[model samples]
Target chain A: MSATNLNWRAIAAIYRFEMARFFRTAGQSLATPVITTSLYFVVFGAAIGGRMGEIDGVGYGAFIVPGLIMLSVLTESLNNAAFGIYFPRWTGTSYELLSAPVSPFEIVSGYVGAAATKSVILGLVILATASLFVPIQILHPLWMIGFLALTALSFCLFGFITGIWAQSWEQLQVIPMLVITPLTFLGGAFYSIDMLPGVWKTVALFNPIVYLVSGFRWAFYGNADVAVGISLAATLGFLVACLGVVWWIFRTGYRLKP
Target chain B: MRPILELDGLTKTYASGLQALKPTTLAIREGEIFALLGPNGAGKTTLIGLICGLLRPSGGVVRVAGLDIVEDYRRARSLIGLVPQELATEMFETPFAAMNFSRGLFGRPPDHALVERLLRELSLWDKRKDRIQTLSGGMKRRVMIAKALAHEPRLLFLDEPTAGVDVELRRDMWALVRRLRDTGVTVILTTHYIEEAEEMADRIGVIDKGRLILVEDKATLMRKLGSKQLTVQLQERLEAVPEALARWRLTLKDDGHALEYRFDTQAEENGIPALLRQLHELGIGLKDLATEQSSLEDIFVSLTRKAA
Candidate 1:
């Protein structure tokens, strides 16, 4: 479990630095989710909810709450973690961090942990805003927290991979913009997959975002298109895959070394 | 003296197939100021990068204070600090926070007093609260030095520490380095400016084409390669050195307006008097005569001279 003796202080130092950076520009980073989710609420919650009452026995406004939160969580996790590591590389400050007594685990923990923390906070804020437009109830607040934390942690690792893989700022945007956004929108962020035709619904099953959103939605409404266990397993599976990629990156010194 | 750092055929060949370091072996003794001199493509930064664990070696081993770099990297790294040639980083943070945060990266607990002392030593105490982006270039360099010293490492690597810095900071940095050496810390720096190395180093290493061509005590290197030059401003231009004075091997320079001679500095008799006597006898009227010592720059050029 312990890769190297954990340097808690070192981890905290990096963690503190990253957190401080986010807070330094807190208005912009936090505003992203708040503004986007508000727009989603305006377009999907009110306009659509006014037209249609419910989906799968849940109010249309409440139906997309978990999905909206997950949508923000996934993208924000990617953005925060990618920028956290990528900025250091861009600025050449990564040299000092790499040279320090800090281990790979500590470095990853600091960045991924900071990204997850940002995700959770932003998720909660968006949840609160969504509550204004849609009266929401959580059947299992504990699982909701668990799924939220897990999704953040997983995507942040994925983001770290992106950060390392990217050689430029333009590359940093490719996956999130081109791949994740399309996948999230098509993964039933605003609608249920069960409402789709069989062929299309089957195709939606191929999208990994569905598992994350469905499990998160299940945490809210106690109903899900996929079994909660399967969703949890898939999320865990993705987390493991991302962790593997991060491990490979550090071991090989991929983009971290000259 | 015990060696504080040792490298055994440490090689780094980038994936792109550039051999940045070629099985270089070197040892740095404790408490000496060692300077690595090299030209632009000479791999000076690559060497520093390897020692500080910023770049992985393709082969071989490095030990710092008896700890293997790869096997015991955390311990080895904790004992060393690096000030890279140029650091590109966020200027949003204050120097104070950077110092504290950097120390913590080495697993050192916060030491407000020590941080303050380092800042004062770096002449950055008064501006500790100012955002780094607002600081001048020299002030920023000082902050880099302070950040390196925050963990109280025994060995420090400064890669082109004064590359773009102002003259004042360069002078202050040299003084600060001397002060650090006096306190028993080992300093190794790389510079393209021969004078920086000449004025600071106790020992020097010359690197060219990824090879460490030479490493010698600065005094010894200077003495071995050191020479003297004599320039004679002629009373009138000479089309060529007179055939009668060919025995002295003098070169006519400045469109034959000057005569130049090179001689060993340590020779018991440089034959200057004999040459002057011959010149006078040959009716070579001298307008002026001057002798100058060959600097480290001259020695470096001769040593790294490209094959004709």
Candidate 2:
């Protein structure tokens, strides 16, 4: 569609509204991740890294930086996007958006755009905090930025779908806390999948987060648990899947309209 | 002149097999106040919902200024504003920010001056900086109105605008609605208060059990269906309405101290003269007599009851 045909003003309005809510609680929104990052560094980087030397030619402390950042980015992306849409639905203000001149695509763009922007900023902050604890190097700065942005965008889209599908507060928290968080932990956020036993290592390949962490780590250290191509393809595949679900939700008006 | 809004057989049936709005057709002219009257569960809100795009119609079409709401939604929606029944708003935001947000959400550019003018018009300019949650209920309602008008829509819907407001605030809302009409904005409001319709509407529609039973000019409706009552103060008290006055359907009132007769305004013969002659012949002296026209509330109640 032509840009003139789209409602750019509406899109910006929604985006700014969501971003304003985030800024209103900026202290709490930023503090939780920063504090969590610090605890992770103190426990894993300082305590554990001193005992376990290096993996794949990178220092133990530096090897976990990319994984830790991915974990935070993934969780934050899901939460920020889900809560952004969910709060409006809960409060009944979504009626304005639904009745406005905005298309479904514009609505998604405004909400997911704000959510991804927030997650990306949090990821960068965590990276900075990680640098304070350990020396970090980036072998492919451009690719690293690409993976970070793509991951954030893809997860935010997924979170948007979750927000629409969820009928209650419990339902909204279920997927992000129980499903995504556990998957990130089991997918190698703390150690390389190669360190697992034969069967476990093969099983870890099925977890999508492993590919995200592998691709992100490859950008930092020039090596990965899986091939970089497969990791990029996997991330793209998840993004496409999320887009399909979001499209279906709007088309069917499942829980959005009656 | 083309109507600002046209609903051609619009209907809404929920997924649970409950038809909220039956096939209904309506045309509202520009620069007029149209009041929709209905009791609870009578599809007043449902009809508003379909026109404002809050609920999709099960069948038929809604056109706003020649644009189909479904096909040309962007243009159609741009021309309309709705203040929903619920007090749903961004409670954390100030009235100024809320108005600005609403304007932009409707695809309008930021015009701080326009927003300020709307706030001032609604008497919310002094409270512009306070959070909406902290404002009184009436002020919050005014904020809803300001938000709806911020986009400068040609057609506006106020659903139950004074549902829970005090009498004084209700009068203020009535005045506000009139001012909006003077500015050439078409106002359509659904109200349970029939007096509100009597007070302001150029036209009135009555919906019942998902069906729009009637729509007519307010003055014409009152004249056609309205009735007049004649109360006769008798010189002496009686235990019952005398059998000689049976033809007039007279009912005893004030413990038979007065006799009442109701007659349709449109009837060719009201029989008032014949009834007076009969009373005189019966030797029942008249102390006094008075006549009163029935109100819109009476007409509304009779219409809905007959439909039921």
Candidate 3:
């Protein structure tokens, strides 16, 4: 739709509302990732890096920066977007949104936009924190930004889907904790998949997070376990899939309307 | 004048096969307070949900100010404001922020002046900065009202606006509704309180078992359906209603000390005078007599019972 025809006001309203909620609990929202990133650096960067040799010409401390960011971004993007929409549904405030003049696309854009923005901010914070421990360089600065934004937006869309699909608090936490976090860890967030033996490497390739981490790592050190184009395509594919699911949810009014 | 809101054969059937709302049609004129009166589980909320686009209808059409709700939803929804029965709001946000957010969500430009006016009108100006969750129930409800009115919609739906409120708050809400109507906003409220409908509505609709049993102007419904009871106090206790006064269909009450005769208020010939004369002819001296009009509650109960 053209810009003139879109409900920019309503979209902004939702976006601002979600962002306000984030800022309201800023301490709690920002603390978890900061602490988690610091712990990762202490355990993996300092202690582990001291004994391990450089992989692909990059020191271990600097090698894991992109992976560490990917880990936090994936988790935060899913969490922020999921909680943003889920809280309204749980509190019955979604009735207002469902009845408002805003369309489905506008509603998703407002929520996903805020969530991706939050995740991106958290990613940058982790990047700065990682730099404090070890020197970091961006071999491909523009590509790094593109990858960060696309990954955050894609996961935020997925999180929006989870928010709509979830019926209770437990359901909301299940996928992120039991599924996404494990995938991020196994996707080579702390280790290069190339270090794995032949059989394990092929199995690791099935994990979508591998491509995301590999692609993001390439932006930092100019190397990747998976082809960069394939990584970008996978991220775009996930984004498109999330959009389709959201469209179907609004069209069917599943779990939203009687 | 054209209706501000119209529902044409709107129906809702859930996946569980429960027909929450049967095929129903209604038209609400501009600047009138229309009350949908029904007992609990009578599809009042369902009807409101359909009209407000909260629930997709199984089959039918809803139009707000001549705009089809489905085909032109953005414009149609912009014209409506809803205060749902539940006090659903962002608990962490202050009333001021909630009102401003709601106004912007409805596609209206920010107008602090208008928001302040609404808050003051709802007696929420002082509590505007307090978190809604910390406010009293009545205050939270007022916040809901202020939020719904933030955009100044043409048609407002207040679903059970006074369900659990105290008498004082209920009166305030009634007065507020009147003020809204005076300003030419069409108001549709669902209430089980017959007195509320009697006191506030220009028209009342009675729904039962997912069907609209009756809809009529308040005065006309009362005139046509309301009945008056005549009680004749006996000088002496009677064992039974006297056979000579059988034409009146009197019922013995108060341990045979009073005889009651019910007649339609709209009837031209009520036959009360003739019944009293017949009592005297039978040498049943009357100690006193009284007549009482049936309230809206009585009519509502009878209508629902008959429908059931």
Ranking by TM-score, best first?
Answer: 3, 2, 1
TM-score of 1: 0.95
In terms of lDDT, which candidate is stronger, 1 or 2? 2
Clashing pairs in 3: none
Each candidate's root-mean-square deviation in Å? Answer: 2.0, 1.2, 1.0
Over B174-270, each residue of candidate 3 has an lDDT whose tens digit, in order, gives 9999999999999999998889999999999999989999999999999999999999899999999888989899999999999999998888899
Candidate closest to the true structure, highest TM-score: 3
- TM-scores of the candidates in the order shown: 0.95, 0.98, 0.99
Candidate 2 lDDT, B142-209, residue by residue in tens: 99999999999999999999989999999999999999999999999999998999999999999999
Docking class of 3: high
Q: Which candidate, 2 or 3, would have the higher DockQ against the true structure?
A: 3
Worst 10 residues of 1 chain B by lDDT: B299-308
What pairs collide in candidate 1?
A: A91-B88
Q: TM-score (0 to 1) of chain B, per candidate?
A: 0.94, 0.98, 0.98
Q: Could you tell which candidate, 1 or 3, scores higher by DockQ?
A: 3
User: Interface Cα RMSD for all candidates?
Assistant: 1.1, 0.8, 0.7
Chain A TM-score relative to the true structure, per candidate? 0.97, 0.98, 0.98
Score candidate 3 by DockQ: 0.89
lDDT of 3 by residue, A1-258 (tens): 788989999999999999998888889888888898899889988898989999899999999999999999999999999999999999999989988999899999999999999999899988998899999999999999999999999999999999999999999999999999999999998889999999999999999999999999999999899999999999999999999999999999988887
Model 2 clash count equals: 0
Better of 1 and 3 by lDDT: 3
